[model samples]
Target: MAKAMRTTPLGGTRQLRRWHRARILQAIRAEAGISRLRLARKLDLSPSVVTEAVAELLAEGLLVEKPLPPTGQGRPSVALDLEGECHGVLAWEIDLDRMAVALLNLRGEVRARAVLPPAPDSLSAALEQLQAATAPHLSGVRVLAAGLSIPGLLEPAQGHLTLAPNLGWADLPLLERFRAALEALGLNKTLAVVENEANAAAYGLYALGSLALEHCVYLSLGVGVGSGVVVKRSVYHGARFHAGEVGHISLDPQGPPCRCGKRGCAEAFLSLRRWQEAPTLARLGEMAERLAQLSAVVLATLDPERVVLGGPLVEATGEALLRLIQAKLPRYALSVHAPEQVALSPLGREAALLGVGALAADFFMEQMAYEEVS
Candidate 1:
């Protein structure tokens, strides 16, 4: 006998049904080919409740049933799985060099993708480019939501982009613009989520469920250095949503000038753009020392379980840079925090794109739950 989920009188029935559907879908996703009885036990729901929710999901084309082999059973059991082909979400990464778009199925598999050159200086041109690139893929697929990853400061609650120095974009209503773009493509019902590139990568790593911990830091090294902090699988946007601008941390007041108009900032020393020429051992050592200082600050402040290094620069340097950072981490981190606490990102340049895809998937699930409730 399973314990029934408790409910209150205020919108309790609707909420309960929605919760049951979400849990059933989540459980099926976690354990593909799960049986209804096993799902009932896993979720601690009564058979009737699970059956009702599963029926609704099956009818919605969100889930499918496959007959399982039987051994000494009165009837064959059916395995449940997500209907990946029928629905999907969109992921977009807007970078200084290009705009990458991908369509991912319910299982997080990339069904189609495109990479286009950087958008024109005009905002309307950028939106038009996005729509044109995305419209062709929406022919046979139903898009539930979209996630946009930008290399800039974003106020997600307000749907505004405060700044993207590299792209010369500032103080724009980015989310509204993206929604309008989707509407132009005949996806008015699709929800849109906006996030910083680093933040999106951090959450994507967490959502991947393979290389992430409860608390981790993703250090994005590229033209400009940045980091995203994930606490309990969510981005820890600090007060004013500027928590992860570690690149601006000043190591010296009179050193080289940074793009942020500050002297002696970490970005001035550590940005990949600064080291384009062939690097000598001495130069690598210098970069290592500066990165060690930045890592020290991050470990001292966040004390995250892991510090993941990512970006074009990291990929270019390969294992050598990771080794250098690992060797230097000991000088700054505590003894308990081993050098192994630092690692290179396995997802590489596609990290932000994949992260935004995961975000879109989550948003789609939430939308489905709310739609069911209504």
Candidate 2:
């Protein structure tokens, strides 16, 4: 078993059912418009089992049977898809200076969104404000779950936020605090999850179809770095749910030291904080040599289909980074075609926020599927 932790009051049987439904929903989610036969095969479940689960999900308005388009062969097979408005997921995405809350439906549409000043470090006040921001849209929409995307590390299994390092908060009991907040708002939710900001952004990339390839590495160059990896269309959240912490990869053994107590991590070179610290680093062109050097190192190891460069600094110095990747990557990897491979994300600052919304909707849809099955 992979690090099991339950935050629900449901009995053992009910918890098993919930886990089963969530897996099924995730399989369907990986590929859109997949036939029932293929869905079962992908999940390695029996045809009867797939049919039963699909029937239950359809009843709960979580899955819809869509008409298959012509395939130039026999009659098109029936396909399964997520139904719009099946449920709503609320996201409270936190950053250094501000916070964003969004209510998203099952079909991944944003129905309502808001941004507010981040509450004081006290967890209670933050929860109260978020609950109120989310309450107005709850009627007629099933609220299956919500997720809190924080800038710092969260030990999701333990339900403990191991300090927002940038904000100087330490060892906060985040999940329990959130539970208290919801109870005060007259709400009993199915579940509330804690997701890393970069991981959420990576999830957003997939849920929105930015990736159409086998493997994608989502790299963020914000105040810090976070990586989200998609293997076979599902997130590979390592044994400890800490799979893609690529920002900490050491680039220079002798260079500046990271707050992680390590030297030469990518964030040490590419982050906005570093760029701002050096008044001479105002133009991307000035940092072109350094950005290219870092890009070459990242590309040589990951060789991702597209190296999504985004953050405040990526814009100011994108051209410079591209040039550096083009120059040093060829020298290191000996690949003549390396320059044009890395692509910047079309969805810049919005990437992380959008991901929070998607994960929330996914949590709700799967929860509903399990309830209907019971």
Best by TM-score: 1
**What is the C-alpha local distance difference test score of candidate 2?**
0.67
Please, what are the lDDT tens digits per residue for candidate 2 over residues 238-271? 7866677777877778978888999987667667
Lowest-sum lDDT 10-residue window in model 2: 1-10
Q: Write the per-residue lDDT of candidate 1 for residues 252-326, one digit (tens) a residue.
A: 899898777889998888867666774667777778788877887888889998888888788778688878888
- Number of clashes recorded per candidate: 0, 1
Q: Which ten residues in a row have the lowest lDDT in candidate 1?
A: 1-10
The TM-score obtained by model 1 is 0.93
